[model samples]
Target chain A: MTGINTPSARHRRRTGRLDWIWFVPFFGFTLLFLVIPTIGLIIGSLTGGHPRVTLKYLAQLSQPQFLDAYRTSIALSAATALGAGLVGILLAWAAIGGGLPKALRPLLMTFSGVASNFAGIPLAFAFTASLGPVGMITVLLQQATGYNLYHHGFSLFNFWGLAITYLYFQIPLMVLLITPALETLGRWSEAAASLGASRWQYWTRVALPILRIPLAGALLVLFGNSFGAYATAYALTSGMINLIPILIGQEMTGNVLFSPGLGDALAVGMVVVMSVVFGLYLLMNRKGGRWAQ
Target chain B: MRPARGSSWLVVLLGAAYFILPLVATLQFSLQTGTRPLFSAYSSILTASGFWASLGLSLFMALAAVAIGLLLIIPAAYWAYLRAPKVRTWVEFLSILPFVVPPIVLVFGMVGLYGNGFGPLSSPMVLILAAYGVISMPYLFRSIDNGLRSVDLRTLTQAALSLGAGWPVILLRIVLPNLRTAILGGAFLVFALIMGEYAISSMLGFNTFGVYMLLTGQTRAHAAAALALISFALVWVFVGFMHAVNRGNITFGPGAR
Candidate 1:
């Protein structure tokens, strides 16, 4: 209570007793479910069917299958995040300052709300219906131009295909997170223009600097989002793609690979990658949020 | 102004195309894919055996998860806002921790820790429910925290305290009722999330709606398209409900990340 919103001494004294009781349920539940489970995975990743620690699973991660899963997943997440970050900033810029109809802002915000949450399986199937082998787009392209999509190495089960699927949510998320940052750009632009700077000069010299942090922060978030995603890609590929999540799934169900310890290591690797990106996001966002507010 | 306006219009339209094209395609596919009559795919899916069971299980779990999640998040977030800045910071970080841990990995950890069928979390339903509450921590916590941010809790609590209302009475009568919109917003968002969740349920061998949709998609493409639209509409309805309850104030849904 001491350093709350108003941090006054009397207010601090009145609430001197730390209200830690209210946090018990939240902490207790998370301790049992989230924290403990994570610790278990870390320990599980180290051991091989025994309580004592070993490095077998750790060594297994160096194999092509596991290495490829980690590499390909990172590549997938980065490509989509970078792609979404660029396009999303453009879209956010257009919405907030485009001088189009004023009505589009709320509409796009609402749409973004729906589209961002509209992920997981249905999204995968929706894309499949639109672009699968016999899908509408594929069929229409074939009929219209005598072009066969699957024949052209454009299968819905491949890496690029999954990137497009992920962009469906990633773009909206980027737009959503970066819009406030974009909204604040106008005040600075007006200031710059009033000071006789050209719009392009203003952007390169002023606006872009301010936006770089938030944009990077947003991209980091998008990377983390897609990096942690398992359901969408799994639903689309049905275990065809050798992503980390798919590998983890295989290990868990004992279908193709049955090493639970390896799965634990994969999970731990995933957590580390995501935590690094997320930690960077927090650091950037703390500085970036200064202007947006 | 004229050039900027034209380019902006183009950009918005292009983005709109990417957003709307799949929806139009899905609707067209759902309508024409099955037996002769329109919406045959939908009708067939409605009559499918596992459809009801999976959908019902997901819905039931959504309610259970929401009930349990709100119970855990609101008080902690509320008190953090009022009296515990350190705890608030810690909870906010924990809330977003779910975002860092993938659903599959979280369940992987859960099974590794408690797969012995000895603890309270052995049952698939219980495990999935707990996993959901954890996965949904980000959205639920964000939504309620947004609500808390909008309220003047200091003045409200102080006034309630001056009126001889105890902590329970204040929390129940004043705080809860005032936060009704926000809590409901968080609940509906959580509802939408759990409805479409796949990995945890499927990994645990639970027949949730998402698992059912994937199965249908493999066997029957047309009915699967129907399920896709139904799934899409459910998300829209629930997210739209969140906005409506908040009177058009969008709460970022799962996009809070």
Candidate 2:
């Protein structure tokens, strides 16, 4: 050990060796649990019950049934992401820059933290109780203003209904993620104002360009978040709808024509879509982060 | 300024209303029993065997997942910060991979790999916990790493080393104590996430709290509402507790004012 005393080799054998060892557990566990499962998914998707690698299932993704599911899910995610982003940015802007009471900020944040994490069946139930058919608000509005929510085709089981339910978490999530970015906007706006730009001009020209990448990133996040959502949609529609997650769940659980391999294909398809969106999000975030510096 | 202030109030009010309305409605619905206000739903859920059993299972799972996450994340994050800076990026990416991979997709992979009806991954508890650990990794890593970021790790490690303390002593006595708030924050988030998690457990055929809620939702409306509110309360408790722990200690960066 003493004879092999080159500086680089010593450094490598001493500190670098132990340092790399620290990563083993994290990477090993991740590889065992996360990476293997993902590889399983990919292999499972490409292969079939025969376990021989084939592109048959990958080709299944383009079928009308599967394509329709993807379409509905994408549409739902896009609507919710866009809706949540606009409203969340508004809410965050109001909370940060709005001339409201100073005490409200912390309260808003605590609530957002709670609400953003508040998902699954309970959240779906909350929305159903409020806006579902025969719900309190639905009944109240019907009796008070002759606005029959159900009769008017506002069922809480369709794409729009699911999108609204998603906003319960999404809007707050948007608020939480976008708030820090919003905090950095103040000095930029003041600088613009000092340059004799009007408020609208400051927003449209200065603020918009600066915030573009981050906002787009946030919306893409919102998109991916909703796109991957399964439980809420499943609980709300009970697999009546053909969303991709529901379809995968249905196939996985053998509720309808169990094909484990096809389920894998659907899952693989979802990962591809989510990965593309997430890649865009990361790209935008990198650009935004660079701009911030 | 006046108009901006007015619109701000309006926006905040409307956002608050959107958030609070469902909760209020659910509470009212849970209290209702055949046209009379009552605690029947609450009592029924409290006495239900499945509810308790599932809730207990979920609690155990959440704890186990948090422990596993802490064991894996704290050391990795600490080491990355101190000596292995290159590993940090990979850890961060893997931790957040759960966000990209839907729960259903992960479950599909699990079923594909381990649905063989034998082995460690065959057990619902082991499989769900492993999956839960992965799902909770992002939150746990983010919170703890954020906390670690607020501490001067290099200086502290060097200080502890120069004081004649070993690595274990430095980590256990010096680093862990300083990271109390971060650990608690991460643990709380992990707990909240595990308790509310539905997709993995439900898909894996486990009777966790979230699964029980979904099952109860189909047949029992008021009971489901009560359980929903209870779940919301559980999350609030965790968030509130974390908020309290992080109240004055919210550091934006190392030595940041």
Candidate 3:
């Protein structure tokens, strides 16, 4: 059956005309919006008012506040990724390990899907409405135990509070990305286990090697996703919390020190952070693609 | 080798409880109707003009953004998949650039470029551009790429060409039908995103659904809760619709891509 169909007869020859017409609108929109805005941001960072090129804006990175913001952002991103990824892997293992009932699989999957995509300001509102001073849970807890979490400094405006809120979405995203990888493991692992292999040995010898690359790649994507996030933190703390995205926003809005050049330089810093993360993601993805093949 | 089922149920229950706790609280707050410090905020927000206008504006913006996104993405994606596969990654990366860039940064950039006498900063059109361009990236790129992966574009083009069908006809008749489910799923996801987006709209001086919640929360806390409830419900519905479409596609196997 395979020998009957050959590539020689039906394949059409290339015209080599290089169809340029189709690319015009696509490239035009990309260049105008994305390329131009980014360039403007970069140039804006390089020069202050009146458009004279200078390096004064770049030197603002030496400021303590900017440095603190950068450190906090990196730390938060790393912690979130690590926590979410580990939990996600565990959840995937449980769900796809034949440990859960058949009927519950779909329900769990749907819930995880919704929760994974569920973040940003609404999530913040949800958490605050439940845990704030006048919040429902807060009121209930106080009435029952004469103890208010808020009075004990459980404010959602702080760094730890923000991290908890961020986890509302991060955990689910990790589960969603990792579940498919688990599903692909199928009955092979079980068959190996039945053949006298211990659980740890089976996973180490078979599954871990196969899944490590994709897991690493997913972790990179999650790290980048949290690192670049702005809305959730912005809405929760009103940009009071010193995060890079918040600082960038403050600078852009002229709320900070009035230096368009400095704001642009801060934006350049943001671009640099995103580029490094994205570069890591691309590298991991390339490795993952090879592994998948 | 079978594990006990009760542990699984416990895990599922714990997960559900964690996910639903905040939502249940929000709903309770939204439903309160008293006038004192705790209760009357919901009723007031429900009767407010700003609430209604913001809701309408948010819906309008979301719909417009989705429509514009579809129009732009369909053609661009089709062209990339069919003619210039080499540039596909770069094009996709560009499309999602706004998303990867901080929202505040993008909003500030927009203000710098178009605010004041230069152009329309506070205009709804600018919000639409930002929302559509940023949020639509994942949807457009994923759906279109999946659709392309599912079919043989070269063979379809050749077959259509031999039968005297033009490029437009082939695209509309042959390509689109296969991509319908993916497009629908993507659109729904984009719609949900725009519905929840707050930073861009709020920063740019527009009153989106999220902004309504923030604004109302300042004075009428319950009203803010009500707004949050409404926003949550809307997003829930959109997510449900996306899941349904995806499930249906999976069942038939036509939309698996």
lDDT of each: 0.84, 0.82, 0.69
RMSD values, in order shown: 3.4, 4.2, 4.9
TM-score of chain B of each: 0.91, 0.90, 0.82
> Which candidate order results from sorting by lDDT in descending order?
1, 2, 3
Off by over 4 Å in 2: A1-16, A49-51, A291-293, B1-3, B35-37, B247-257
Q: How do the predictions measure up, each by TM-score?
A: 0.93, 0.93, 0.88
Itemize residue pairs with steric clashes in candidate 2: none
Q: What TM-score would candidate 1 get against the native?
A: 0.93
Candidate 1 vs candidate 3, DockQ winner: 1
Model 1, residue A224: distance off in Å is 1.0
The prediction achieving the highest lDDT against the true structure is 1
TM-score of 2: 0.93
Task: Please give the lDDT score at residue A14 for candidate 1.
Answer: 63
C-alpha displacement of A18 in model 1, angstroms?
9.3
Model 3 lDDT per residue over A1-293, tens place = 55333332222223235455555665675565556667787888787656588888888877998889888888888888888787667665666663676766676666665666566766777778887768788899999999998889788778887877777777777777777667666665778777887867777877788788778877876777677778788778877899888887676556887477877777778778877777776687777786554
> How far out, in Å, is residue B10 in model 2?
1.8
lDDT of 2: 0.82
Clashing pairs in model 3?
B34-B40
Model 1 accuracy (lDDT, Cα): 0.84
